[model samples]
Target: MSSVLLFFQGLEHSPLSVGLRASEWMYPLVNTLHILGIALLVGPILILDWRVLHRRATPPVAALATVLLPVARGGFGLAVVAGSLLFITRPLDYAFNTLFQIKLVCIGLALLNIALLHWSKAWGLAIKDNQFSQSVRLACGLSLVFWLLVLALGRLVGYR
Candidate 1:
């Protein structure tokens, strides 16, 4: 009866949701794309984070970022679009799912970590001088943790 519930109910009954729910192939196709998108997003992130953490073992941070950021951004975009479509199919269910809630939180934190890192002077230090300060290293470590949590929680959201 509340506005939020009403909004979700409306989403659940939308033409797009109804069509996706009734379709035999569309849901599966979107699900596949969501998985692929996560793969693309997480894979680059893992490599980049690891490289940042282990500064001596990889190429320059800027070089790797230049190559990886676009792929990660594309993946994130795809995932969000596909995920939104999937969510609309059962808006209330996802809106209430605790696992889904946690997944969203983890994703937010991961994105925030990225924003903070890029905005801070640590980023330039890491990129130009190959120097990662404690905060930068901690951010990279947290990025890894947050993303992994998001991945696991996403799977659990579907499992439950």
Candidate 2:
């Protein structure tokens, strides 16, 4: 307990500590970029999921993956960079914040969901044939939920 308390104290006193003492606009700028990256990441995933769910379009699964995967990856990469900077500005508070922990867990779950979708033969079939099975639909739904939660949890960092 003492060690943890000391760690937090050190973090609070660190020259890079985030708070009113930090440059006024820097934190918000980083946060804005992080949000934009999240928007980019979620947009394609949502669209692809909707298409798979509704059977509206029939683009080849691999083709769809090719188009969206890079966008999603780029967004993720940007978000990670921005988010790390944000954390660096206030490592101690963020490290202890429950909302931040939840956000990280949600991110992990979202990544796992994406990996599973890519690895599953059914998901490939759905993409290639543009015909999603019940399982694929369920996966899509879960993916949506997980990503949304990640966003919500991120917001909660400010409120809680």
Candidate 3:
């Protein structure tokens, strides 16, 4: 058999592939869950970042972070699970899709942005003082942009 067919055949025998194929509605269900998770994850992050940028009625940064971080983490977990299932349904296609690759890269950048915010002493001091500095503002803007890119790229996966 051709390599592509062999790869797909291998995927078909995997547990995730079997699960994805076992139910006609499974892929749709997983896709829905993935969307829900993305919404949950992005919504609070956007709101918090906007507050940081606009400086209007901003909550204490620590308080906002505390409130949103857990929710975002939960959503991340759900998204990962559902996304993995969705990917397993057509692993070869997903792996080769430009949109999917872009989405992955965007996700990595977003995660890196978050890590930088967490690790930066300036960010820590700003949060402690309830002030959003220029650096923090830039991070917030980049986070929003990258995440939106991720969302758009994720949607484009099906088309591409």
Specify the highest-TM-score model's number.
1
**Against the true structure, what is each candidate's TM-score?**
0.97, 0.83, 0.89
Stretch of 10 with least lDDT, candidate 1 = 52-61
- Candidate 3, residues 35-147, lDDT tens digits: the string is 99998899888878877888765578788888998898888889988888888888888877888988999999999999999899978897788877799999999999998
User: Model 3: clashing residue pairs?
Assistant: none
lDDT of 1 by residue, 1-160 (tens): 8999999999999999999999999999999999989999999999988988886845888898999999999999999999999999999999999999989999999999999999998798778887898899899999999999999999888988
- Model 2, which residues run further than 4 Å from truth? 1-21, 59-62
Better of 2 and 3 by TM-score: 3
All models: lDDT?
0.93, 0.81, 0.86
- Candidate 3 all-Cα RMSD: 2.3
Model 2 reaches what TM-score against the true structure? Answer: 0.83
Model 3 poorest 10 in a row by lDDT: 53-62
RMSD of 1: 0.9
